[model samples]
Target: MKIGKQDATYQLERFSKTQAEFDEHYEKDLQPIAEKLEEERQKTMSLAKEQAKKLIIPALVALAMIIFFDGFRIYVIAALAAYGAYLFKDVYEQRKKMRVKIKEQLLTALIQFLNPNFTYKPKSYVHRNQFIKSNIFKDDPNRYSGDDLIKGFVGNDDVDANGIKGTKTELSFSEIKAEKVEKYKDKNGKTQERVTTIFQGMIFVVDFNKDFEGLTTVVPKQKGLKISLPRFLSGEKGRRLEEVELEDMEFMDKFTVRTTDQIKARYILTPGFMRRLYEFATKKREVQPQNTQKPETLKEAVKVGLNVGGDQRRASQDARNVAYFSFRDGKMYFLLSTGKEHFESGLLTPINKSLVQEYYEDINKSLELVDELNLNLRIWSKE
Candidate 1:
């Protein structure tokens, strides 16, 4: 599964291959790696089950003690937790080993298999500064960590930018978790700390085909009565952003825009551009294993929007409209709140063809954003 840098570079042109072609390539090139991974998967599951069986007797005894003798209940509960962790240490280590192997061997190959132009980094992430610069989320998060970084470019053969046909658009996305802590005094005068999640999802950044000045941010519209307010009036810092009203009713129904330059915002969000955004937001592109009774949890997040100050508490399944995007620095920053880690082999599931297909589909769906947003067509040159 070790792909040399030169080979990967040579295969950069394969980014345009269709899913059927990928399936053909997987069968021909990746079968051996998949078989080796299956062996590791089976061994890991057997070890986990053996460890689980050993815990049953002690767990039942602890449960009986808690039910019969309530005096030592708290101590027994704490002891049980400690004992469980100690007993499952081997299982945890085994699973971790299996996880890393899959990431290194199978996942890495699958990424390059899709597009060798793309580089997959399981340990690196998009920087928090880039997140801040996005200007989509107002609250700054103190804690941030991410992995499974995929970076590369895809060319639209039919589109032109500058003097060149087939414009190459750079795009990258990774799973990120950003959180902030707040300290507030309770009614009893004891200070308590609460950790609020600022944004927990995929941060997708892509090269904008057009050049525009200032920053334009589009976020999901607030429910109930509608009122547009300036960013400074609403306590936003830096650029003075004023809300831009659009003519499209459906676009207005789905989003609200704030921009430092009103003219550029209007120019960027044309009726066609707005329709593409709305269509992409509402599209049902969920990637799950086919025909599985118990599919892995790859469903869209209920609360995908930025939960600033712990304001958005309810889980909304129709968070398709819960997207955030902004234009700045010759790039379009897009955020999809898919609050789950994708493309990892399940511990209990076999690492077979279906698992590999699932991985392919997940990355493919994300890459589809390029086509969905029509990012390859240049609208205007930089001033």
Candidate 2:
């Protein structure tokens, strides 16, 4: 199941459609959907503004009561809280529906334009079982949820490297949020549960239609340091896996490879593959904000800062853009730890061209990973 250089080039060419071509698709198919959603958005906001205007007088009265009438202050605050909720409940529900519409109607159409054969499911996600089976993370998450699932096939469907007609490369990914909840006692001696995020990003799994006999896990050097440490020293309760030492010092500096079979580990982590993995892990892709509406409140500003992930590298070299790779069961499982939330619409802004472009690029980047790792080369197999 291996392909030659010419076949590999052909596969790359087949999958690499220029951004201009996608822009054409966006203008033709997706633009109308966005425009229609914008119209609904305008109507919804108009009604919301009118309802919100009624709050100003009540708010002023509440403020005056707090200053002049101390006894009635609590009652006035409670009354205002209930009234505000009643006024905005419809608007909140409408905006919620609009978010769903953007994902279902607009994003779905964009995915179709990218590849008619590809399937986009907004509600479904990769199962938790697959995450556990990969064994990339040491601790299993107590809570798991995700959305924006994209599943499809790449490679030349017309002919295989051996002149057979079939596609061997299949790609699937989803935005996952996995967390671990731990219980602890506070200073008051009362037990409380603290939720810790284990992983928050995309879990990309590729079925390369090739088989491997060993499980090889590649983690960032810092994490590798912890895992590769002796059991007596680190107190690691997981399965003991031997570290695979490769000839490339640069790759070894950036990543730690642990495997069950030495020969198979070397077979997969060749010099070129190691270089690619290093570059992919070190390089940061910063996605600029698509929404034009600036944040008015401090909370909104803080949220925007986190979401855009301002252009700053981590203080530590090993801590920047951490990526994990596990090769097992004839599939390559990649866990990308991007802290920002992907493919979400801004609540304050209507759908626009820039927003649509952002979604397109975000998704297109994920699809390009197959080529980035040279997975379509099919240089080895389980035979």
- Which one is best on lDDT? 2
Off by over 4 Å in 2: 1-11, 14-16, 69-75, 156-165, 223-239, 287-321, 381-383
RMSD of 1: 8.4
Q: CA lDDT, every prediction?
A: 0.69, 0.70
Write candidate 1's Cα lDDT for 333-359 as tens digits: 988765455555446566788777766
| Whole-structure CA lDDT of model 1 | 0.69
Worst 10 residues of 1 by lDDT: 300-309
In terms of lDDT, the poorest run of 10 residues in model 2 is 309-318
Per-prediction TM-score to the true structure, in the order listed:
0.77, 0.81
Collision pairs in model 1: none
Per-model clash counts, in order, read: 0, 0
